[model samples]
Target: MAYVLTGCVAVIGSNSLGLGPIAPEVARSLGSTVPTVMMAAAAFGLGTAASALFLARHIDRIGSRRMLQIALALLAAALVLSALSPMVSVLIVSQLIAGIASGIALPAIYSSAAAIAPSGRESRTIGVVLTGWTLSMVVGVALSAVLADFVHWRAVFAAIAILALAAIAMLSISKYREVLATESAPLPLEALQIKGIKPLLIACGAFMAAFYGIYGYLGDYLHHGLGQPVSANGLAALVYGLGFGAATLLDNVVDRLGARRVMPAAFLATGVVYVSMALFGGSFTMLLIAVFLWGLANHFGLNVLIMRLSAIDPARRGTIMGLNSAVTYLAGFVGTAAFAPLHTEFGFAVSTFVAAGLMVVAVLAAASRPTEAIVHTVQSERQLQ
Candidate 1:
């Protein structure tokens, strides 16, 4: 239960620290443009990426539980600071700290889930737990926007901060103690030595550049480009969220397909949507379908990759997952930053084309892997007893 709560908290932290519904309001407050206000989002991503790389192995060495406690405290502090921030720069820095807390918590929570995998339900259970976070993001964006419109954006952030702090207090309870690691595992720095993972990281990096590029600008696209209201943006976001929810529904299928088979199909589906949108940008219905499918496939691929990392080294889960999150964020930074300039010069259609190209490459890379039932290995491990 503690792990479950913390996992959700970790997942939602980035969105909470980010622009979300408050993008316009925050921009107005800072006397900045939308693109400039967006750098806060980029900063959060960079912080997550950097911290995940730097602190992942340390969590493995110290123990996930202790790290969770510390992370929660940091998160609480960062939120408070952000709530009271007097300047945009201070707010951005606070957001970076929040990103670090998020980065630290993700691997530890994932490691805990992998550690506590019950009987034959590891994948499903993991999916269910992770869904909480995705749900938070979808809800957070829309709800936070509403709150920002009604109340001040600062109040919206203050509410999120309080929730995070509440979660921290809950996590400190004795009943949730199992989240702690028993013995410090020696960091398997050699996991980096896994020849294919580095290349896989590069491929993912490119994929993310495209992913974030489109997604980072999606709200703006709907609002500025399409002249839609925030309510419309929320509805669109709902469609995208449904896509993520759909993937969780298919978690068992994903587990059966394994990474090699699942990843390529997802990327292909994503490319199809992006290409369709690029060729015909004015069709709202078509774009909606594209966004929904893209969200579904992209998130499915993301969860699949996450599960794969959790499988790599059972005992050193925090380190591995942390490293993966770091990579994930690094990709986000590249995607967001890359898209901003592209959106400025070429427009959304061409920018989406760029994203589609990256997905094509990701599909090819995913296909190159040997498909020998990596998912079945856990079943084999169970049978060996």
Candidate 2:
């Protein structure tokens, strides 16, 4: 789990750190506009969407740890390619490859973690693994910005590649050998047809659409829309990162409150914060608080949703997790694409409210379903196995 967690953190951090701030610089170097250059981000997400559905079942059949290793190799290659790319298209392609690699690694890791954890502890286990992800955001973007100030962006990519290689090497050690050999159940797409899974997926979809819509655009909103200084933007992100990190620690609390109760509260809080950010993004202090609260609620809700899915079919761990990530990236693409046009025409307030309302719909969908004991039994068997 630690090895998987470490690899996930490196992948998410490196990619996220370079996403927003580097866009304009890459565009300038490539002789392009921000929108054109932003294709790199979209291309990356497209890779995720493609890989998750296309390769997910195979990943389950083959073994998640094996897929994870392959993903690391691909990520390393992509990072090196990104560092050396002279053309904007090449950079976009490289990032797309990296995104696919991350897409594979994430689900594999989460499924492996869920499989190994004790009964009814999937949430706590996922929280631990996700902590590394949150920590990476806290450190990755902030450090990347600081490094970009002192060094070149190419150097940043090179450094991330080196770090990925190191994590890959660590994962190959004997201590993690067991994970590589752990058995998982065959893919069960039919289970997805079950009535309960439908509402669950819908709830998750709406939640992610809203969450990523805001997340993908927050830095841009702060920098361009709100007129904040670069450092201020980074500082606000730090607050957001802290909120994500803090939410991971709330896993037990969430479990106690029940996924049903906690989810609605989180959605409502995050939605409120999004509305607040949209309304007062111009106020530095006010925006900072809003960003923090937004991060807190959004992350708590997302992790809980992930735990719910992990429990749904514990046997088909890798496939389900892969689907989870694939669906998430797909929704992210929808959110990012939707927000671009909305921000251009209707402005942030109207668009943010719409996103917030989507979250409310998610909460309602979650409310419609009752948690069942059959899912709990599956979770137990996975843990005991």
Candidate 3:
């Protein structure tokens, strides 16, 4: 189950991060500008948000396994379309389709992870699954850079398609088929009204906006602001991904320190790193270090958030997770779309600080009473155990 969940998430990561490293090159090839090409990211996020809002409710009714299979098929088709796209519009549409697939797939995977997780080890199980996303940062973003530099950007999508197909094959095995037979309760609309959910959703939105705003443009920033070669984009992403992957090992730390204490700290630390990037990004070493720290803090905070949300309502885990995904991706869309203009008009420093400010807001929001509620909830669950 863990392996299957990881494989599914890896496809999501590839589809999400695949275009970042090659945005500039794709723009050049399509006779467009970098900011224009970046719209694909926004489109993808919008699609994901839409799917999470409208389609995710059906996951519990249809069963996670079936939903995952449908999502994988969508992803495969989207990748092929992306590879074959002749115009920027077509590429944007392809990305949108891929994003919708991811939105549908990821929440199902998360719900499955929660359902099958061993008692007292739920966070660890979810963390292990999320590591697939971090690995995607390496394999998807980093490798895309190398491939884009050597072969062509189109090859990146083709590679992702193959991986998606592999994941489908893995799911087709008899063991997974048996797992998919289990049915979950339908998602309740009242899940939205659960205590602490609203604030957490707000925090997630702010955090994603801040994080993706910088990340969506990191490649162009390195090329334009630091005057680095195209290859540096992938190398920097690799370093950041390594940090993210490494941080997953510390999921146990969240259990020890408690999420209430850790989440605000991570948000604060990530904010500082974002500001540092703004101040010292001209130095390649400093930029790399800041990016690494950003990934580390961001992923830690995200893990805690996921664990908390998953624990909120076991019966509605799918719904809560899906809504969480929707909020995050909507923020991603806004951030990516907003950053392009901010960076274009005021340059990297201003844009970076804008992101940092959003992180600060997220920190404040997360540190509020909702966090206390989460801490109490976790403590109550542990006492029951």
On lDDT, the candidate that comes out on top is: 3
Which TM-score value belongs to model 2?
A: 0.86
**Deviation from native of the Cα of residue 14 in model 1, angstroms:** 6.2
Off by over 4 Å in 1: 2-18, 27-37, 174-191, 223-231, 370-385
* Full-model lDDT for every candidate: 0.71, 0.73, 0.82
lDDT of 2 by residue, 301-324 (tens): 877777777776655656677777
Model 2 poorest ten-residue lDDT run: 177-186
Give RMSD (Å) of candidate 2 vs. truth: 4.0
Clashes of each: 1, 0, 0
- Predicted candidate 3 versus true structure: per-residue lDDT over 199-230, tens digit per residue: 77888998999887888788888998889998
How much is the lDDT of residue 186 in candidate 3?
Answer: 42
Where model 3 places Cα greater than 4 Å from the true spot, the runs are 22-39, 86-88, 145-155, 174-191, 344-347, 370-385
Clashing pairs in 1: 209-335
Worst 10 residues of 3 by lDDT: 177-186
Ranking by TM-score: 2, 3, 1
Model 3 scores a TM of: 0.85
Q: Model 2 scores what on Cα lDDT?
A: 0.73
